[model samples]
Target: MNVMAKAEKKISSAFIYFFGSFGGILFGYDIGVMTGALPFLQADWHLENAASLVGWITSAVMFGAIFGGALAGQLSDKFGRRKMILMSAIVFMVFSVLSGVSPDMGEASAYYLIIVRMLLGLAVGAASALVPAYMSEMAPAKARGRLSGLNQTMIVSGMLLSYVVDFLLKDLPGEWAWRLMLGLAAVPALILFLGVLRLPESPRFLLRKGDEAQARKVLSYIRKNPAEIDQELASIKETAKEERQANQKTSWSTLFSGKYRYLVIAGVGVAAFQQFQGANAIFYYIPLIVQKATGQAASSNLMWPIVQGVILVVGSLVYMWIADKFNRRTLLMVGGAVMGLSFILPVVINWMMPNMNPMTIVVFLCIYVAFYSFTWAPLTWVLVGEIFPLAIRGRASGLASSFNWIGSWLVGLIFPIMTASMPQEAVFAIFGIICILGVIFVKTCVPETRGHTLEEIEEQGTNHGRVKANNPEN
Candidate 1:
């Protein structure tokens, strides 16, 4: 490529990466904003004593996401990933405003906010499923890990941005403060919508739809070498043809039978474990946990999220560096081990020294978040995006995303109640156990996908029982 042509291609590639993953900002902001807003929301709605009600409001988006993810997955299969993402951005923008302006109806307003946030959750869920698949499809296999992992980078960056926004708006009147925190999500949604307009559709999707010409065009922009573009297109064609012949009608049944069953289990297991590890519990309730632990006001501890957010962002950056270089299974195992230890040690410390400093728990939680940001958090999406067959990628990813949201919903809803009923350390210990289980799951089920093409991964899935025999890495 000539110097000027190379520059233009670089700019185009940069824009694709930014806009394709931009939906993470919307997803991250919605999930993280409530971390700061909930304290004020509880006071405004007189939910001080109603832990269940508070939990419901906090988890409502994740509840709605379950349906949203499943539906978007099926729809994206039919309509194309780019179009579904565009639609999601629009939903995000509209519902974020509605959530902010929810009518005051005493406790009923909480339900109103719940309904609105659930609608917004559709977008969040769709983005979670779509960004990874889209990035994986658009990326060259050699660069796929780093490119797919960018989705997590954007996710943590969005979270950090939300934390900063929450802190800046903390001094506003409670009603306005929370309202603006919820409402400001619309700005990133708008940016995503605009950016999606300029993005090329995934080449794999285009080829599957029998638009080889357009697929070639998209590959041209994303893959600079002509030989590489032709090679990838040929591989996609071969895989799509085999998938069509093997299963003329792809459905949920397809995912549960034959070669696909193992892939789905592996993908969905990783997705679900990512949340079941209790990262969201910490992310969503950091300030509240601090309040309960120290008797300090939750509002005054808003800065804690900023601290956690910074750790998350820094960790994500580190993950991006190592994403393509390390084995996925190794990263997950190592991260889960450290993360579980972070949680377990806190409980051990509290037992040994009953009068330990309150900030000690917060410090451990920060360590948990740091390890999580680098490992399971990003690798879940990377593996999910890489492991599925081409014809079923959309639905499989969506299924995985829904499972992920289901785990998030359960943890977010139950964490506060568990903390209220038991010692916080005990609740965290449960999560620690779950993390240990996660490491075992990765060892036994999840295959390493580092440096492998999607086509190669699918071939390994086809030879299911031989995967461990052939690779010795599974």
Candidate 2:
């Protein structure tokens, strides 16, 4: 290729990775937007019976996401991955603006906000499932972990953007503050939609649909050498053929049957545990938690989230650099141990002192954020993207994503009520216990997936009679 052509190819590859993973920004934005908005919404709406309302508003998007993820799995399998992502981008922009402009219908305003948030959840959930799958398929095997890890990086970046926006608008009087925070999500959504128009569909999906010519054409955009193109195409084709010939009756239940059951357990377990470990309590309600802990007003608590958000972004960058180099299970366990300690130490210090510095708890929370950002935040998505066979990849990933949202919903709903009744230290102690359990689960159940191509992972599936095997070096 000429110099100009090479530069153009490099730019194209950059955008493909950026725009392909851009949905994660939307996912993280909607999540972080509410963290800043909830306190303002409560004040303006004069919310009575506030805890339940808070739970409903916070958890509503997660409820919608469960269905959206399942539906996207089926749809993306039939229609191309590209189209489903485009659909998600449209949903994200529209509902986000509507959420910001929610009407005040007396007591019904809460219901309206919840409804709009639910719609936003649908888009977020779809993007969560589709982005990882699409990126994993398009990227080369050697670079797949880092490319897929970029989704989590974008997710943290989105959260950081929301935090910055929230801090900027926190002083605005009445409802405009939260409105801008929620509505501004549309800007990123628009960017994702327009940029994706220039991108090609996933080559694996195209090849699976029997369009080898188009698949090769798309692959050529990223793969320079003809030999490289032929080798990857052959691998993808071989995996597709084996999946088709081996399992004519691949149902969702196959995930739970003898051979694939363990894979489902590992994939779905980590995804669910990521949420159950209670990170969202910090991501979604840090201001509220700080307000209660320090007896300070919610609006004044904005800077703490920005601090946490920075830690989160920094940690994800660390993961992006090292993800391809380590065993997936090793990182999960080490991070989990640190995360568990971060949670447990705060509770212990608070109990021993009884009047300890709230900033100390915040420091541990930052530590927890740093560890979770690199480990569970990224690797859970990475494992789900690579572990399942192509035949079952879409649905299984959707199932795992749905389970993830379900855990988020439970934590979002219960955290407020639990905090209202119990002390902050005790509440986090519960999460600390859950975090330790997560570490145990990772050590016992999860498999290592380093240095394996998607095709090699699939071959191991064929040999082991399931999509993922526990031996870790197959």
Candidate 3:
């Protein structure tokens, strides 16, 4: 190839990596945006209906995501990944403005805000499912873990962005501060919409549709070495042929077949348990937790989340470096054990010394953040995105993502009530126990996905046994 051609291809490859992963920024931004905005929202609305509004506003997006994820999964399979991602970008931009422009606090206004936020939820829900799948399909085999793990980096980075934005605008008069935080998300959404315009559809998706020529064209830009490109293309073609031969239909019941049952179980278990382990409780209500523990006013506690966000972002960076180097199952076990201990120690300390320093709780939370950032946060997406066969990757990922959002919805909804009605130690202890169970689940059920192509992993089923991909005939 000519030097000019090589340069052009290099630029194109870089764009694919950068813009392809860009959807994750929007996903993370939306998730973390509300964390910082919630405090100002409560103050503006004055919580006369605080209890109900807090739960509804925080959980409304998650509720929308449940349906959005399931729908996107099915639709992406039928239509295409690029189109779904582009569509999600539009959804994100439109509803972010709507959410920001919601009317002043009132009975009708609160309901209106919840409804708009739910619409925003749809965009984020689609993003959560689609981004990882898109990246996984596009990435080279050796770097799939790090590339797929970029989604989590973007998520925590978005959280940190929101926290910083909230802190900068905290002193702004009236509700405008919160409005700006929520609405500014549209900037990234608009960028994503434009960025995805030039992106190629996933080669796997194209091969599945029998458009091998176009798939090869797309693969050439991303994979520079001719031999490597041919190897990947052949793998995808064979997998597509196998899928066609198997005559798989995108049905929910297919998940229960003997071969897929274990994959689905492990995928869904990790996805749900990732949320139930309660790291989001830290993200969603860190200010409230700090306020409760430190005896500070809720409105004045915006700076603390920066601490959590930093720990999270740093941990994700660490994961990016070591992601493909270690066994996925081993990292999961270690992370879960440390995370569980972080929660357990705080509860025991608080119980033993009723007047323990508030910093003690903060220290434990940081440790939890450190471990969770590397493990559950990124690995859940990695495992779910790559575990299923090409025939059911979209649908299975959607189902797992829906379970994830459902768990998120439950945590966002019940956490406040749990805190109000019970001791924080008891609440954290409950999560601690869940994390310990998560360790066992990883050891027993979850398979090792690193260092293998998605097709290869699906064929092998698990590290413990050779349970092949599902056969529709059986």
Candidate 4:
């Protein structure tokens, strides 16, 4: 009976973590399924020449994400992370079906899909912000990086699943193919909703709510040792008390004030740069890009996303291995340098050869995805989850997530327009420059949080503020 009880506890803990991070699947599926669905959508809606409409349809989720992230952040703080995730799951299920059944009314059909998808974006944005914070809170500092990275693993896995689904269903007659692709997201949303029903609230949130007995109960399941649970709860309680006394009230402006300002800059900057570096431009439209460069049929181009998806999944697996071992700054800097070169090399090769093989572009993009999957893609959320103080963590994380979506929205919205007007090499070259700047930002602004407890990280931020205050010249 004792052995059986231990096994059951382990199983329950694993399920909690799995469902806690499962929101990433919903987020990743919506972003990726569109890649396969867009071509069919264009044909079904007669939008072949309407580049701007395509951009809006592609970017609409991101636009909605901006508001959703911000709103969820505030609400999660007040209501708790578990509740917000459940709410997000419900939003995802409803809007996903609505998106699939959208009536064809010419241009209005496209507009209708955009509106439904934008509503779906609410859930996507919430998941993006909630998963990291929840995962970070549940995990021990030693394992936090690897555990939190599970969110990214789930995200890329969802993308891979979407790509595979797109390939399998690409042959379905007419609009039904894309419609089913959009509606299928509801399945995962339903799974997340049901699974989250059993998840415990964050122990830290429970402590903040002045529910010590419940917080202790929640921590017992996550932390194996009773002594460690007591220590962690005490540390969290002390931090919460100090934060409450110092700030007295939390607001959006709190993220930009005092010691938090520096932390916010680092966290939000990392989040924005992750998207601004143009990974999504490839993820969202690789099929279209391959068609334009190689003069291949769009239908044939669907295979390329599966190739990218495989690379991403493999890279994410590799990241889970190295996540705790390496310094966050080291990974970000190295990945940024390589990713930037991947983009620039194609432009340089084309200049030297005058007619570079289009397949070379595909090879270089795969390299970019490989590096991004392991680094900025997962580390951004890891850092965002670690760097903020407990009092404002929810709101600050939301601010960071909103900025992430803003960058994604811009990339998705403008990539087609920019490609329409300029050389593809030139467009990618711009992204390469942004990558270099990102490396600089990480080196100077971001601190090393590897193996540090959340309390210790917050203390480091506080100490750094003191150092800066004492020596203004530094």
Q: Rate the local accuracy (lDDT) of all candidates.
A: 0.88, 0.86, 0.85, 0.90
Give the per-residue lDDT of model 3 (tens digit) for 1-474: 577445444548768877887888887787777878888888787762467578888889998998888899999999998999999999999999998899875777778989998888888889888988898999987888898898899888888988888888889975998999999999999999998988888999998888987788789988879898889988988878877786777599987677677788988889999999998888888888888888887669888888888988999999999998887787889999999999899888877898888778778988999999998899999888888778888988899989999999889888888888897778988999999999998878877777778878777773334432222111
* TM-score of every candidate: 0.96, 0.95, 0.94, 0.96
Best by the lDDT measure: 4
Q: For residues 324-387, could you state the per-residue lDDT of candidate 1 as single tens digits?
A: 7788888899999999998899889988999999888888888899899999989998988889
Model 3 clash pairs are 47-50
lDDT of 3 at 170: 87
Please write out the lDDT profile of model 2 over residues 1-474, one tens digit for every residue. Answer: 577545544547778899999999999998898888888888889863589889999999998998788779778988988999999999999999898889988779989988888888899999989988998888887788899999999999999999999999999985899888889999999999998877788999999899998798788887778998999999889878876886656668877776566677888899999999999999998998888878898888999889888998998999999988787888899888898888889888877897898778777888899999999999999988887777777888889999999999999999999988998778888888899999999887776677788877766554564433334455
Candidate 1 residue 313 Cα shift, in angstroms, is 0.8
> What are the C-alpha RMSDs, in order, of all predicted structures?
2.8, 2.9, 3.8, 3.5
lDDT by residue for model 4 (1-474), tens: 778546545546788889989999998998899999999988888787888889999999999999888889889999999999999999999999999899978777888888998989989999999999999999999999999999999999999999999999999986999999999999999999999987889999999999998788778888899999989998999998887777668877777778678788888999999999999999999999999889987767899999999998999899999998888888999999999999999999999998789889888999999999999999999998888888889999999999999999999999999999998889999999999999999888887888889888788786674212112112
List the candidate 2 regions with Cα displacement exceeding 4 Å: 1-11, 465-474
lDDT of 1 at 52: 90
Q: In terms of lDDT, which candidate is stronger, 1 or 4?
A: 4
Model 1 residue 26 CA deviation in Å:
0.9
